[model samples]
Target: MSRPPRILDGGTGTGLQEAGIAIAEPWLTSAALRDEAGVAALLGVHTGFLRSGSDVLTANTFRTNTRALARMGVAEADRPGYVRRAVDCAVAARAAAGTPHALVAASVAPVEDCYTPSLTPDDDALRREHRWMAGVLADSETDLVLVETQCTRREAVIAVEAAVERGLTAWVSFVVTGAAQLPDGDSLREAARACVEAGAAAVSANCFPHAAVPRALDQLGGLGAAVGVYPNLEDRAALDEWEHSAHSLPPALTPEAFAGLARRWSAEYELAFVGGCCGTGPAHIGALAGLPVGAAS
Candidate 1:
């Protein structure tokens, strides 16, 4: 039998939400570090994915940067501390799992609302903030830095540069709309080009409509760099009144369905990595890990 495909962890925020952990912020990444149960919940989620056979476990540093928490009234002086705490959570979780083969990846999310790329700051702020966060993660002992859910070409370029500057392997992932264009309506090819120009080790599609995966893979395939996908599962749990509504609801992509999709991508398009985004949990990742490797076509 061929070696098993490596799997990445599933969605953290949504997994926490589904587990009855709640924080009242629009961006709840680092806030969970403040709550003891939240930290434990995050650790549990990380350990869960590890036990489920994830090769790479992403740290929960998405909203830990100064610019993002500054919006939630977190002081600039205290922001980086939260990032350290987030890293500690991931490290602790990995150690608890005792999986030496699993590597910890620091998650670098967009500074602005992931749903709105237009809100991405100007070049100056983008460079300043992303560099700061990437530096923090590099110091956190993470194996790789994943700059995910990016939308704009400019930010993607800056983010990938920041990651590469820290001497860490990086993958810049874009979130696309149903039409397979980025949130700002730029072509995915342009975004991939920008990341590659910045020296990203890989380019990926993430946190978008599952139906958008194949189109994105088609666009990203044969781009001369490693390609990956970890698209969002539909049927997200209701976190709050504002986040839960008919408009936001989409069909649920269960773990089995997700595994099958990943298998297809791996077989046909030469996917370098496979995992989940929002609405997925360890169960989803377990299903992915359980896929049997087939003979090459």
Candidate 2:
């Protein structure tokens, strides 16, 4: 029998909470080692998921970027060490799971501010930060690097370039809303092309509200590159409120509901990889596992 296609797992930092670790102020806590117990607890959660059959594990470096570390008062010189530490945590957890075939992705996240593409650092600075982070991640045992939650095509370019420069396989994932538009109002298709032009191994949408995923995937067609999706589940009330307040959509669905949603993607994109994002945990993944290898839902 042919091997089943891969499904990428998402959101390990918050998933730590489910494993009995409180990842409060993830931005702040990720900088300092104050939450040592939390770190261990979080690592255990990742181990559980790996054992449960996740194809990919993202390192706990989402909020450990230099910009985020600087926000938490970490000295500039110490930021690289924090990133290294985060990568080590994921590596150790994956090793403990005894899943030799599991893939580890070094996660590079948005700078300090998110949801405001306008606040992104300028080209030179953005490139500098991305280069620094991607370079560090490349030196580790990580199998690949994921540039996630990017809201601007410009920022996406910097990340893709960094990945190519280091000769690491990279995936560029966007965070979008109902209309398949990035926070800066750039179309997802444009962003997808930008990543491809910059030499990304794949283009994906992540952390978007559930309702927007299908449309987002529809928009990804014919990009001549691999595409992926990992959406979160938000409650209806929470989704509506967040959309109105932040002008961003919410992803709200039960694990089964999300599985149905995820199942759709498998049939549509041949080069597709599907999984969970925010609000998705082991149950969501379990539901998806029941579907046929390429069945969407």
Candidate 3:
């Protein structure tokens, strides 16, 4: 029998912001590691997702890389500590939630803005930065490395290769401009294939509007690797929009509606996992967990 899909947790940075945490640019969710209250809030967010039956809890290391930290004015000496703290919060939250089997994935984002492919660093910078970030995740004992929201194929390949070189199980995810198209206008099929060839155990399309996921998944099929999606809570009308204005508009789907869509995606695509991106919360995950296992058919 086919295995049930794993439920990845919803948006970490957005969830933190919803929880009243001040996550500024250059630090993002990583800034939540600065104090006891922030740490407690982080743990609460993780435990909430765990209670909602998430199988994977991604650490808030999205902006802990050297390039991001340098922009935040953090000294080189204190950078690793920030990354470790992000991992530690996830580990501690897993322990607190009493779920020993849930995986803690380190978030390996692009060296620059995830949406602006033109701002991507040179090939050397990509390799060097991803190598350093992957080394830290391995050293921190992350359950896996999630190279997510990559706008370019080269960055995804380099990041996946770096994680695999450190003996980490890496899953790479991309952001798309449209169905089967990367934000940089590359074919998603080609990018997914490249990452798979570079040692990615899974390939996914993420952080795009919900309407685009099915077509993206269609292109992702037959890659010989597990496929998944975690789309942002944007409606079909926002398909061409990259920037999220979630605060100004109501959510595109209620928790129940989101769960219903996830069920359809799971059954139709045989998705290895289904989860949310921006604007999702524990309630959305809880709804997903309530769906019958092996619902895919």
In the order shown, the candidates' Cα RMSDs to the true structure are 4.5, 4.3, 3.5
For all candidates in order, the CA lDDT equals 0.79, 0.72, 0.86
Error of 1 at 130 (Å): 0.9
lDDT of 2 by residue, 225-252 (tens): 8778886564446444223221222335
* Candidate achieving the largest TM-score: 3
lDDT of 1 at 117: 74
- Relative to the true structure, candidate 1 has a C-alpha RMSD (angstroms) of 4.5
lDDT of 3 by residue, 145-254 (tens): 99999999999999999999999999999998656598778999999999999999999988887888888998998998999999987453644476544332345888
Sort all candidates by TM-score, best to worst. 3, 1, 2
Weakest ten-residue segment in model 2 by summed lDDT: 241-250
Q: Write the per-residue lDDT of candidate 1 for residues 190-222, one digit (tens) a residue.
A: 789778878988889898778778899888866
Q: State residue 24's C-alpha deviation in candidate 2, in Å.
A: 4.6
After TM-score superposition, the amount by which residue 295's alpha carbon in candidate 1 deviates from its true location, in angstroms, is: 26
TM-score for all predictions?
0.90, 0.87, 0.93
Off by over 4 Å in 2: 1-3, 19-35, 239-251, 291-297
- The lDDT of model 1 is 0.79
